[model samples]
Target: MRCARSLVRIQSLRALTAAAGGTVQPAATRKAPHARSLIAHEPCGQALRSLHTACVLLKNRPVATDYQEKSEREGEAAKSLVTYDDLFERAALEAKTKATFNQVLDVFIKRDIRRRGHVEFIYAALRKMPEFGVERDLEVYNKLLDVFPKEIFVPRNYIQRMFNHYPRQQECGVQVLEQMENYGIMPNVQTKVLLVQIFGEKSHPVRKYQRLLYWFPRFKHANPFPVPHQLPQDPVDLARFSLSRIANDLDARVTVYQLPYTDVCETGEEVTQPYVVGIQSPDQRHLLAKHNPSRPVFVEGPFPLWLRKTCVYYYVLRADPLPPEEKVEEPVDPERCFYYPLQLELDLERDLGDDDSFDVDEVDEGPVFAMCMAGRGDQATLAKWISGLQETNPILGRTATVFRLESGVRELQSAAEPEPEARPGEEEEELQSRGVKQ
Candidate 1:
């Protein structure tokens, strides 16, 4: 009976191997039946099972290899797909104007009904807005907000709302609003409507819009001295504007010494003259008139004055601080004030709480006689300005003028100087070459 059971197990093992497409010889075909029975005993069961598993794997090998190849090809194809930035670059190839920018956005909308990869597209658009000169434009921002699909990201349930559904898309929307805020652009009614349609009423982007509306009005005119957006393009006009801004006094008068012009002489050389504009008030003129002829007045600067993004330079005529002995105080005329004394000598003590003055150092610098802006900072150009000043205040000629000009100022090319002669070594080399030829 044991022999029969062993034979039955051997038969079952042979059947499994054959089904797995592996060869198994029958006992009648074997040279020694005794040896075969010993090999197919119960201990051989695990070995037979392992052989069958190997046969099964061999049969499926081709399919596995094919599946791996197919997966690699799919990965390469995914990598080859064009990114959102490529779309903007392609549009910019023609022109990077506002019209081209709008056309690119329009093409993106028409290309896909579902607007795939829109978050990436919006980000790319935001970065490119400044290049196309539409960073401050409200319409472009509204159009960008329109790219997001409506009602998809809006939360359907309280759980979805609590967890901040579609966090990436919401963040993208907020970034668009942030860029608008940076450019000082206020969103319109259409922007609010678009945000509501895309991200629901309680989203982060909506809150940002509410905050902008609440605070934009309060700070719109916050700058006490607001500069004009479009500055004067004419150099003379610009000089006038800058000089008046620095003068501070309403009684100041602007004098244009020279207007910018280009002259072509009979010798066929082009000569360009820079503009000179100066400002002086009644007080400044009066101070200049009292200036002593013994002491010298200094022409100092190309001090920098910034108006918005533009930088301009101006020069000032000032004097050295007088010595303590030379300083004279003007006495007040008591006849002008009949009700009370014009000069008061008081000795009053005050509490520390009553002191309202700022505790800062007082610099006793010399008084500024006048201020001027010119296209050129060279001495010759400034000399013409001084000549012009002598007309209004003749005292400027009597007071010895000293130039304290700094090299920081931009000076225009005054008739280009002749190039220095060749170096001594090069001249000697030329003489040697001529002697060798002889």
Candidate 2:
């Protein structure tokens, strides 16, 4: 009875399998179909396919490190392969604007090329600017000027370099200036100053002076006031004064005039020495006449005929008044006070001769007061003179001040005191207004 029951159960199982339209299979074999059905029904199959596709794509794609290495190799090859001529041709073809041209020139400049060659390349590029459809402007020329190396050399070494680089290097700046003029681009004050600095660096004293004088008028015209609050004076006069000061500092022979004394004529005293030749300012004449009526005032010098021509070249430029303590009484005209300072200009060249030795008594003959103007070259000399005076005459030294011609009387008066400390927050406010972060 048990065997028959078991057999009947097996037949029932087979019948169920047939009804499901499949044959009976092992559990492991059946599991795959079951899982596939579950995945298909739950939308996980689509996700799995997408993941597989992404993996394949990622495996085939270029690696960043490999890409960068390849790019670097290509760049190195390109640098070695391309010539400046090729660059020029390429620029000519595609550099169609001023900015583009500038970019091309910048590239040329950055390349490892000889300085002269670089300059030549720039000139060539500029010549073809119109062909490249680039418009030239003042800024372009200025940029070119800026590209010229402005390496400063010590004065002695500069002389040597100038000797070595003569003609070619010297002509470079001049050529640039000429080119700018040709383009009808007027150089501004900054440009003039730059040129002046360049000339000063490259040339000797005589050449430098000549170049300065040549450009000074133009410089003055462009910049009417080099220092603020100073009135515009005659450019010629300023140039002469500057040159004379330069010559004096160099210990070159400078002619200085002495005011004529009437005692020699009135008392019938023999005139042992002739008066030093100088051009007296109208103010000087007015002062002499008012203060010393008995004094013989000579308009021109009584001098040897040969000395007269050379003496006129050098003149007493101006005199600055000593402090009140030095003068017994204030001048009737305060303006004329500068004309008579109880000082004398001894010709160091005459006294020292070729020996260049100075006598202590000769140097200390009278109180030495140095005249300095702001923005002028004589400040250093003035400082030296002041220091010397401090040792020689303590009283006069205390009264001496740096004569800042650009400063007003009030400014000068205030300059004697210590500068006021800034108020709280004022400094920060000023910096902020100037677009600086404190």
Candidate 3:
């Protein structure tokens, strides 16, 4: 009975191996019958099961030689697909004209991983110039300039690293210029402007001055606008006369005082008004009189108007805001809340003082003096005053520096808003209108 069971198990094992696409020996081919009979006498069932398990494990295992052969075939196919001939054929087929050829080359250069950063691709295109029949022009150079990376990224200290890399970028631009020179290509104003933009900040002051001197003469010859004899100096003052009536409306007089620099007028003296008749100068009284004939003039001199040594003192009565609806139990001090002390220093040379007069309008034709504001107060209030001064007196806006006094003097930041970007079609419309007018 045991022998019959062992023979059946051997038959079942052979059937499984054959079904699994493995070679199976016939029963008649079994040479080791004695060994099988020994197994049948012992635990033949467990032995057959163990044999079957070993066969399954061997069948599922991958062959190393077959895998390696498949990989080699795939690699060869990829290499054939990406060869230089294949790439060049595709690019040439896509490009018919010079412009289109350049576009194709640009795409190829940008997309090619091996040739992205290097200029060898450019040289390669130049070699193919005969086939494309396209002569390299300034546009081609500009396109090449566009290919050079303008920015580089660093994982740490990105902003600083970018700034440090700027000189290297400028060097690349210089190399482009040298290449252009070798090709006997003369750069247009636009190309020079591009180089100037890249290398200008790093250039020496003397070179910058020389460039300006060279260009100024040519620019002057073709200039259509009016050119002034001299430009304005710094620390210009702009004052606006208040139209509102004071306590003694009828008796309120515009008194022009040529007081000494040391005199500190009291706030209660009613002299701390916003409006002033005119600036009093000992030497330039006649000039002031000639310009503003109808306005009252006062001559108060001994004020040193020398270079870097002159000082102008202004005492302005702070405008009070309307009281809020909710009444406070305690009265707030006007000196603490409203009035803030301010000092200003003149920032112009004696010679440039005449330019300041050009900035003032005909109505406010007072002497232009560039002055820096020096005092502690609300920045908002200071900004308001500065804007008013700028609107009423244009000279101060252009030339004067208003400094904030808090522990030390610092220049007040201008509150001018940035201009908005024009819409897409607006610029085209403007150009069209301008052309029609011309």
Candidate 4:
């Protein structure tokens, strides 16, 4: 066997040397030991033969082919398992803000010239924009659109256009627009240009852009009372704005009972005072004055009033439903206003005439005498509000008062039954409302 192996090695070396046009000595003239030594000395020939043998063995072996295929499959599966959120997390290491979000996009853009996995990246960006605080930003959205390779997604022919060319990418682009629409962000000219650049003039995203352009302007000012983007930072100012918004009366006046202040006592402990803001119209004051002193009035809250993203607690000074026997109907003056008639005697088919009243029965919940927003919702803080109301209405001083507050955030408690107390031994923001006679 050793002699055969040596002969084979010597034959390979001779064949290589002959192929190279160099003079080769016959393997028959050399001893097996000399042939082995010569084969070891020629590195190139030995390496070539070893490589050829390896290739032949690998071709014939099933295990190596299966292993190579399995490894390739595993690599693909692992790549597929990696989610888009990981990309955002990996990119925005410091903080998830607009700057970080843009940095991530820029990295993805410059990472590959082709912008591979862009559809997935855009979807990830849409999901993350709210966290990054850039969902409503037009420029960020434009930058996101700019990720798609220009003119590639555009259908070349009418056949491609008719058959939803690049369906996945088009859907992705539409998804981006849908998210923008959900946020009530009106797409701008630059947004249109980006859409046109990414998807052709006759694409779903471009159509969406057109629809948004046409309809956004029409409904932009549709909301009569639009909340400002930035709410007031000062609690008092926020309370004032919130109170006035719910008041709905132009004649309603807002009063600040206390300004937020911090004071250091002689003991060197700091005491923080919460603000108190109250609103009442003349009609509300009149109603309060007419309220029966024997019947109890309720100071009910911390009911939540949401202004944009910020939530505020407001208390209402209200009474229970007035009994039917006690309810009085006030007569309207005929000549109160010439421009607008008080009532219509002729009741024909109600068209678009002066009769704007709905035929439904009026809901009489109760008269809200006054509403107030306070920094702290404790009984002590609210008692000050009732005292302030007395200066105007004077009926509060004589009237029986009850507190109907709740421990939960944004919960409304019925002033009718004031028996349920907040469960004891639990630390929460509010203490339960108990019926205590004033």
lDDT by residue (tens digit), candidate 4, 1-438: 544565587567656645754232233223334554555565443332223333433444676777899999888656733656777887567887888888888988998899878887788788889888898898999999999999899999999999999999999999999999888998888988888888899999999889988998899899988898878888888888898899988999999988889999999999998888999999998888888899998888778777777878789989999899988899888899889989878957856766766698878898899999887888888888888888888778788888887774544566897685666663243433364555
TM-score of each: 0.71, 0.26, 0.22, 0.74
What ordering of candidates by TM-score runs from best to worst?
4, 1, 2, 3
TM-score of 2: 0.26
What TM-score would candidate 1 get against the native?
0.71
Off by more than 4 A, model 2: 1-85, 113-116, 132-136, 152-166, 189-438
Name the candidate, 3 or 4, with the larger lDDT value.
4
What TM value does model 4 have? Answer: 0.74
Q: Clashing residue pairs in candidate 3, if any? A: 235-370, 235-371, 236-369, 236-370, 236-371, 237-369, 375-405
Residue pairs with backbone atoms closer than 3 Å in model 1 (clashes): none
Candidate 4: which stretches are off by over 4 Å?
1-84, 347-363, 408-438
lDDT of each: 0.82, 0.43, 0.42, 0.80
Number of the candidate with higher lDDT, 1 or 3: 1
Indicate the worst ten consecutive residues by lDDT in candidate 4. 22-31
Q: Write the per-residue lDDT of candidate 2 for residues 119-232, one digit (tens) a residue.
A: 455556556655654433666666665555554322346557557444454466566665554443555656645545544444442243345447656755584323232322
RMSD of each: 12.1, 27.6, 28.8, 11.0
lDDT of model 4 at position 48: 23
Top of the candidates by TM-score: 4
- lDDT tens digits, residues 337-381, model 3? 445634335685677545554564434233422121222233333
